[model samples]
Target: MKEQYMITHEPPNPVDYNNLRLEGGMSGKSREASEEGLKNSLFVVCVYDEETFIGMGRVIGDGGTFFQVVDIVVKPGYQGQGLGKLIMEHIMNFLEKHTYPDSYVSLIADGSADKLYKQFGFSYTYPKSRGMYRKY
Candidate 1:
């Protein structure tokens, strides 16, 4: 049977976001943090299997010059179903429609996930620049 899912240009609720993240092998965030983050995102895309949130991705930045793709995740059971690509496609569409020529769009690809981002034109920056992050 073919599974049916709906993609929307909406941010998932805090609970759904955290649940999807955890189920997708990413760390969960506090409800407060998730709420704040979703509210601040420049753009968000969510995938649902009927009423069940199954995946999500969001773009965050100053809305100009610098935009980062974050929280790209799909539920474990839905991982191999091309939902990740669907999420990225929506994100890339937003970037294309809203970003300027000099804008710097980036993402920190974990593990083999870089391969997925590469299909959307993300390239390695290691030779000329390195990605660094700090956790508080």
Candidate 2:
């Protein structure tokens, strides 16, 4: 199989978002939720295998000052293929192109994925502050 894939920073399709998040064990997000969230997203990217979406990522927030990288996911079978890196590259590119000087870009790194995010200039906020979250 070929090892190359295309990256598109357009908004992801609702079905694609469902499949992408489902593969990451976050299937609880309904189509309604996906529709709403995607409508407000600042950026989204996906790595497709022909017609199938194998990976995806998104950024959510206001346009100029605040941005958060969210939902970076690759299918289990597609893991370890640098699809994560590809996704991050697209996300970083979007941030670079859209952000103004001194703008803040943030993401909550899950598991050991901090290493990947770090490659794109994301660092731990320890000593300054720690990331916090609430489960619904």
TM for every model, in the order presented, reads 0.95, 0.89
| Predicted candidate 1 versus true structure: per-residue lDDT over 1-136, tens digit per residue | 1367888887888988888888888887999999999999999999888888888999999998999999999888778889889889899999999999999999999989998998999899999999998875
- Report how far off residue 96 is in candidate 2 (Å): 0.9
lDDT for predicted candidate 2 compared with the true structure: 0.84
**Clash totals, every prediction:** 0, 0
Point out the worst 10-residue segment of candidate 2 by lDDT.
1-10
What is the lDDT, from 0 to 100, of the residue 92 in candidate 2?
88
Candidate 1 Cα errors over 4 Å, as ranges: 1-3
